[model samples]
Target chain A: MHEMGIALEIHRVCREAVAGRGPGRIEKVRVAVGELSAIEPDLLRFAWEAVTRETTDEGAALEIEWHRTEQVCPSCGPVPDRAPGTWLRLCPSCGGPLELRGGTELEVLDLVFAAEDDPPGPGGDEPGEESA
Target chain B: MSSDERDGRRVTRDFVRIRKSALAANDRVAGELRDRFRDAGTLVLNLVSAPGSGKTTLLEQTVRRLRDELSLGVLEGDVATELDAERIRALGVPARQIVTGGACHLESRIVRRALEEAEFPPLDILFIENVGNLVCPTSYDLGEDFKVALVSVPEGDDKPFKYPGIFRRALIAVVTKVDLLPHFSFDLDRVRERVATLNPAARFVAVSSTTGEGVDAWCDLLREALAAKREGRPWP
Candidate 1:
């Protein structure tokens, strides 16, 4: 599936970010997948695991935030009653053309990585210096 | 401290926000291709449709009709095969076949490579017949002036609703193989209505490549699109 290609892209993005931070291992990757996009979250996660296996980012969590397309009617503004995965061509109330808004997103949102000093282990009781 | 003790120390987890599109590389290449096409004054059309939708047949008819009036080039994409490219070349036009191996869709980078390899000449219009798929190809932009989606009568009238993502982004919707309409229970009006709902701005046309029915009208539409591009205007 094309999900493999998407996963590779995500891995590349994460690898670049990780490289910039010096020695580190990726902890998690968050991505936004839109309803209109062709990617399936489960398949993407599977592909990510396959791509990251035996790599520096092995065991990294893949988080997907689902983005739903907003359906709006020319006459009624936003249609709240429209069901998910279903399209309404016309407004149910006033019989006007319905429009879709903002559902093409496919981007890597953020990445969490453990620096070299911070090994994978339990947290210390004392809070360390916080960096944003 | 030993290595185990060091592992227990508070490790910092960095959060880096990198909001970038997965297809950013492809998009960048597509933008460059768009500039090149504009400079060449070429009106490029990216044709997408399901397999067996008669995209090649329609293109053959188009090449036959417009070869004398305008210069044309075709970049045919397939997973593995040069048959379609050969068909276009048989018409005496410059055609290149991009064998994508196992890739489902064609990216702008490969398209740029194919154009370079083919030594494509400056033309009035260029047609890119995408890999015959409705899903994967919709996401990749090939730097075309506009996209045209084709659906034959046998593909059923519900294709627009079933694959709204592609239909919604297409500038033109062509219903191919109209000659088979009498043999099959295909409702052209219903398909038009569905496609209209998906993409209100798309121009709809029905043609039979075999019988040459509505072929002139399709050619006229392409000519108009080419003229609009030359004048720096939008197509109807």
Candidate 2:
């Protein structure tokens, strides 16, 4: 599925953030997946593990926070928050058509790495290591 | 660090958790595509629908009809086959087929390349006939000015309600193959009402490419969208 692509993006972002930190292994990478984004978190996590297996971030934990798109009823205002994976048609409070508000987001937030204390950087590669 | 007193197997560090969205990169790419379309004066329409929704047929007829009035370029997306592209080219419009190579939907990256391969020409409209899928394409932004979702009569009157995500995201809902209504059990009003509920602002145009029915109004809608872009106004 498209989760591979999304996992690739997550890998790209994590790589950029932890680049040149000196052979340090990534601990976890946090990503937010919106309900309307058409991305399945389980598949994305599976893809992440497969993608990062040979990379520096191997065995890294992928923390996915699922976000829901708020569907506000024009007549009733905001719909009540329900458990994840629940679908609602009509407004529970008022019988009004629901309007989607948000939750179609997919973003890589931050990267946590185990930066080894080796006199400044990872393996002492200070900024510009070996060219080529 | 009162680990032993807390009766814990191992004291896990209380790391600060930050919640964020992952679509920032996609949004960035989408933003750039929007700018490029604006600069090129390209009105990109991402046509989405289920299989057999008459997307390619509509493009073929539209290209043939508006060949004299505007410069048209078509980007047809499918898992395999250049047949749609061939059909468009047979109409003499600048068209290219993007075989998604098993992808269910066309992402924005493919479209960005298609625009580049088209020489980034100054065009009136760029029709991106997305992979004939109702579910997947609704989530992916193909860098289009607006999305047009097709619901054919053969699909059933409950199509809109069953797949609200696509219709809700689309700006225009085109009910195609209306000529088949006589033989099909389709309620036009119920479909229209469902679509209206999802996207109240979206406009609906019912047409039949086979019978040449209601095409003028559809063509008029297309003209109005382009004209709105030309006048620096919001497209209807």
Please compute DockQ, using alpha carbons, for every candidate against the native two-chain complex.
0.46, 0.15
**For residues B204-230, what per-residue lDDT tens digits would candidate 2 score against the true structure?**
989999988888788889999998987
Report the CAPRI category for model 1. acceptable
Which model scores highest in TM-score?
A: 1
Report the lDDT of model 2 for residue A95. Answer: 75
Across B1-236, the per-residue lDDT of candidate 1 in tens digits comes to 11212355545677778899988878899999999999999999999999999999999999999999999999999999999999999999999999999888889999999999999878999999999899888888899998899999998888887787788889899999999998888899988888887778889999999999999999999998988988999877
Candidate 1 TM-score on chain B? 0.95
Docking class of 2: incorrect
lDDT of 1 at B29: 99
lDDT of 2 at B2: 15
Top DockQ model? 1
Question: Which tens-of-lDDT digit does each residue in A13-124 have in candidate 1?
Answer: 7787677677667889999998778677899999999999999889999999998878788777988866776677778889888777877889999988777664444564
DockQ of 2: 0.15
Find the 10 residues in a row with the least total lDDT in model 1 chain B: B1-10
lDDT of 2: 0.78
